[model samples]
Target: MTATYQELRRSDLPSLRREIRAGHYAKHTAGLGPGFLQTNLAIMPEAFALDFMRFCQRNPKPCPLVGVSDTGNPMMVTLGADIDIRTDVPAYNIYENGKLTGSREDITDIWTDDLVAFALGCSFTFERALEEAGIPQWHIDHDTTVPMFRSNIETVPAGPFSGKTVVSLRFIAPERLDEVIAISRRFPLAHGAPLHWGDPEKIGITDLGAPEWGDPCEIEEDKIPVFWACGVTPQVAIERAGIPLCITHKPGHMLITDIAEDAEVPVRNPRAA
Candidate 1:
């Protein structure tokens, strides 16, 4: 029988990590490991790591850094004791000369001493929080990956890292918006709260049925579309920067960390006054 989200949610962190490491689970990680943190992965040469780090620093909403690996080290000790940057993620996108070349279940062959890996907080963390708070996630209800789009909002540039922001969308009843925001605000590392909520066109998203990444979710007549800054923003920057080589976890496929969902993350208010 196929594993249900409930069953997966009850799974232990180490076992799930091992399954992902062994390439036994390569699908979207949205509802899995309910109490653990899930993160977006970015691996690139050390030469560009500083600029990318600065880029994340400048755009905290879209690229909040949760963990950074030591130069040439695959272990992300801060996130987990045995997390391997090269193989722990279910899948990875390989980019060459700023374009997607292919994807791999593991990148051990390309791992180099000059490489650096970064783990960015993903919305999955806050999504779990939302679920726990009784806020319905349309995508999860429909068994689809959350829809994401590239917004018109531009990110602050750092060296070779510059691009428009990317966001994930969820439909929520107007009455529940405040409650959802309150629950999500606690996770500063998880992109905080919604970036925009209402019409998709306002964010340069032309079609609600068409997303730049992930699956399109249903929007009920009584609900409004809500957008949250997505870690995929860095992938857009990498493409625009034309970096010679870059690797990121495939959209919706994330790196699961041992960090607890309720663990404290540095609080930086991303909301505008």
Candidate 2:
């Protein structure tokens, strides 16, 4: 049952996961499953679970806590009935001693009893809300990853986890800024509203054309740059921790959950074109 990208965008949660689990999709999950909740994955050893939870608590803007898996279990019952931490996401980043070892579609080979999975609320959830409100997302429209940058702001330390916050960028028309902020504010689990808009330099982001992760977005004279607390902020902390092992969903490669905020929205298959 092969489905085109346009088909998958309108697919039900289960059908999409089937494709992802089969290793058929391993890319940024921005426009797909637009109304449902999405999570940034962070699987850490049992020993670091408590501290990581605290870290999320201290920095809810970037690390909004959504669902947490049992210490040894791969299933995320809190997020969805069928969410398997190992194979559900589009891609996984494997780290050893705080270094990125590799990235792959599945982590079943390394699944262990001591690993605990965390589902951090992602801004992808809000991007859909923005689009629904008629706010444009340049990166999604261009089929590119949203640019992410590190800000000078520091997160409150939780055990050994502490670092500057990361932010996801989008350029939206100046006239739509207030309306977009209102729409995005509705999803607390999705990082809830822009942290800052306009001048990127105010946030300590010196370079607008270059980004620390994801693709650089083209500047538009009409649209102002908007920044939102990014779920990838945790990955920076994970890397700085130097833990023996850590696994995270690659930036923008999120785990889609069944929790729908806008299920009533109708989807059309653009492949009909």
Candidate 3:
């Protein structure tokens, strides 16, 4: 007889982070961490932290600031106890002079004292509610990254930070569109509702099959495409700024936090490292 084990489809917050930090799970974090807040990560030197903070403030829809790690401190006390910014995210992309230079799984070797890390709210927070309401999420069902696009809709400029917005797409059934919108709107921290739906062209998205990030979605005939402001918007701003060194979570690979969307205190798992 052989032991049987099925792949993980649901997990508690601490176990997920422990898995990610240990360099075991590195896939897109779309369907994982259900009901907990998943965040987009941006790490840069102290020199650019202020401008980037203002940038996130001005562009709240796409770049809602949730927590900022103290300068030179690797422990993200505000978001979760013992969460290591350098290794907790599933994947990381490194940028130099506004260009993607490389990617790494654990940035421990490159971590430095001058770096400051910021966690921005991600739309995945509202997904549990959508699931509870019986709204279908195509990407989750397909086990693919949500299709993301860079739009012509300009962001409000803050200091050296400014760029067009990025949005993630989901095709909703005509009957579920209103409920999905209402539920999503309630989570102000999670990009807060759809920015544009129906016409990708209106937002300068020319092709539905081709996306700037994540996997391309196969749109069903009865489903309507709904666009939501995305946390990935900061990556574009970081690119344009061209700071000497910057790091961000790979699109769709988020920093799973111990904080539940509604919980005031961090959730802990005694076994998690």
Candidate 4:
């Protein structure tokens, strides 16, 4: 049976994690676990860990590091009590020499002693906040993943990681834009506030109907598109870097952590203020 967002949202974290680990759920985790924090996953060889860590540190907006596992260990203690990086996420993208090879439900076969796992904050956390604040998410309303695009803004580079920023779009009624921004600003770990709103072209996005990732959402006549820095920014950087091998959660398919969405996250970048 297909699980509705409401059903999954009310489901316990342990059960959801178990279902995801068993490969029974591979769908985008938008409204699932309504008040729990969700994250983007990145796993790479230990040889590239330092450089990737530096990359995340430099590009904090799009790659806010929430949890990092010890080399070769799948347990992300900081994020959850029993979260296993190897099978926690619903899907994983496999990359080789900077190209996408395939996707898998589990990467235990490729898991090696020299690999490191990273968990980056995702905007889904703030989407719930928006909903709680009375701002409806059009994508979630229509049961679609949020639209994401590659933007014109460039990320600060670190080692082999460098690429244009990627952002997720959500249409907001003009009158409520300020309220949405205010609600989002509270979640600094979740790409705090809007990066750009009103014009997509100003950010080099040529078409609102076409998104680089996820389903295209309807932009009602009264609404304007608002953009937020996306966790996929690191995936773009990883692909461009052409690292020997890399793995990340397939876009939209995130790792749902046990942490509460409203839990206070220390500001890793004050400039976001």
The candidate that wins on lDDT is 4
Model 2 RMSD, rounded to 1 decimal: 4.8
Structure candidate 1, residue pairs in collision? none
Model 1 residue runs over 4 Å out of place are: 1-7, 266-273
Q: Write the per-residue lDDT of candidate 4 for residues 225-265, one digit (tens) a residue.
A: 89999999999999999999999999999998877776677
Q: Can you list the residue pairs that collide in candidate 2? A: none
lDDT of 1 by residue, 76-110 (tens): 87787677888888889999989999998999999
TM-score of each: 0.93, 0.93, 0.93, 0.94
Model 2's TM-score against the true structure: 0.93
Point out the worst 10-residue segment of candidate 2 by lDDT: 264-273
Best by the TM-score measure: 4
lDDT of 3 by residue, 191-216 (tens): 88899989789999999899899999
- After TM-score superposition, the amount by which residue 24's alpha carbon in candidate 1 deviates from its true location, in angstroms, is 0.9
Error of 2 at 106 (Å): 0.8
175: Cα error in model 1, Å: 0.8
lDDT of 4 at 123: 97
Query: Which residue pairs clash in candidate 4?
Result: none
lDDT agreement of model 2 with the native: 0.86
124-212, model 2: which lDDT tens digit per residue?
A: 88787777677778888888889999998799999989999999888888888888888888888888889999999999999879999
